[model samples]
Target: MKKKFKILIADRNPHVREFLRREMAGPGYRVRLAENGREVLKFIYGDEFVDLLILDPDLPDTDAPALLRKLQNRLPYIPVVLHTFIADLGHCPDIFNVVAVVEKGGSSVERLKTVVYEILAKDRAKEKIRNNMQSAGQKKAAPATGGKDEQK
Candidate 1:
């Protein structure tokens, strides 16, 4: 069976967190919510693996830029979708892990969902290719079993 992708949604607004959770959970993703920067850090650094993050740079009680930098350093493999207001986009730190910046609006959830799906699909494709390459390399590295040297 395929593993369900786990997503962490971090926003300062309780309503936004819950709304995103409901939206993402409907499609069978394991959704986790964080209402502040501390909670976001806890979830990301915890034992549970997260496949993606939907982050609002205005998260309370922490420096947003610092958090973004830290996440980029520690979890570069996990893609982050910045869910923030359009005006605040300029203040956001440019980080490698941020795959998309989604403006928050009444109709933005659909776009967020589409972005998440595309990112995960791309990741899956890359993983498949890596696995295939590894298998091929292993087959090539294996010694021939029925050669003249084996008979001797």
Candidate 2:
């Protein structure tokens, strides 16, 4: 069965969060909403199965960059996509924890979906490769660890 990935939308604006929730949620994706950076961290730091995070560059509480950085440091496995209307700060938030930075209001919601999928798709690809490698390593070690016992 195909794995369903959990995605988090963290935006201060209710309308924006709702828009993103509607766009990103559907079959094969478990969507969660967070109103601010603190909430986002709260949801993430726990045992949530979130794999992708979409962050608002302009948040209400703490600075977005710092929040993103802390997220990235704590959970490097999850890919973060930053959204904003500001062109200057739109530069890649790679310094913090953002994997991709996208500009808002340039295109329609459909376009944002496309951009978001593109970024997350890249991350999923990398994750697949990592998983495959780990699987191979486990296979190689299985004989060494249990082969003698099984033979006996």
Candidate 3:
């Protein structure tokens, strides 16, 4: 069986959260919603293993960049897709874990899903390589306990 990816959508608007949850909660994905940056932080800091984060930069109670920085410091492996009104993220600094910046609007939902799929696919590829390497290492490390060499 294929592993399902877990995505966390962090936005202040309930509508946005619901829309994202609905859009991303299909096959091969498990979506989690958070209404604020605080909630996002709570989910990230907790024991739950989130594969990706779709974050709104205009979050209440916490600056998005700060939160992103903190998240990068703690969990750099997880990729982030910044879904916001900010069309251009060129000037923004400290973009460590951000994989894509998607502007919110009419067709942004579809764009978000595409980006999510691509990022998750890349992650899956990496995981496969890692697992294969581990399996190869184990095979090499296995001892020939009862082989012809044991009688020599």
Candidate 4:
């Protein structure tokens, strides 16, 4: 069986949070909300687990890049998608560590959905590989330890 793909939407606006949660929930992703930078870190450190983060750069407590650095401790393996209205002539870098930086506008929903789907797909594939490796290791060790009862 597969576990649900968890998504954390970290933004201060109530309407945005609710809307994002609703949109993300449509595709079997377990969506969570964080009202500010502090709350986002709290949820990241918690055991609830998050596979992808959709971060608004101009958050209430902190800016996007700083929050991304802070969140690295708890979700180092997870990919972040920067969601903001900071699109400008040269605001975007040629390459970024973030999987995607989406511009917030009328068509933002479709853009976000695309990035979310890509991130989830990659995360699931990595998780499956890890699980398979663990399974293979257990199987190999089971016989070396003289069967289940002895190993247990």
lDDT of each: 0.86, 0.75, 0.87, 0.77
The best candidate in terms of TM-score: 3
Q: lDDT per residue, candidate 1, 41-120, as tens digits?
A: 88767888799999998888978778887787788799999999978866665655788998999899999999999999
State in Å the error of residue 115, model 4: 1.0
What clash count goes with each model? 0, 0, 0, 0
Give the best candidate by lDDT.
3
Stronger candidate by TM-score (1 vs 3): 3
TM-score ranking of the models: 3, 1, 4, 2
Predicted candidate 4 versus true structure: per-residue lDDT over 17-54, tens digit per residue: 89999888964679989888888878767778788888
Candidate 3 regions exceeding 4 Å error are 87-92
Encode model 3's per-residue lDDT on 1-152: one tens digit a residue.
Answer: 89999999998899889988999999999999888888888877899979999988777888667888889888989999988887535434667798898999999999999999999999899999999999999999998698776875
**Residue 104's C-alpha lDDT in candidate 1?**
91
**Model 4 ranges with Cα > 4 A deviation:** 88-97, 144-152
Q: On lDDT, who's better, 2 or 3?
A: 3
How many clashes (backbone atoms < 3 Å, residues ≥3 apart in a chain or on different chains) does model 3 have?
Answer: 0
Estimate, for each residue in 8-95, the C-alpha lDDT of model 2 and write its tens digit.
Answer: 8888899989988988887778889999878887976788858788877677776776776777678877777767765647443445
Residue 38 accuracy (lDDT) in model 2: 82
Candidate 4 residue pairs that clash: none
TM-score, prediction 1: 0.90
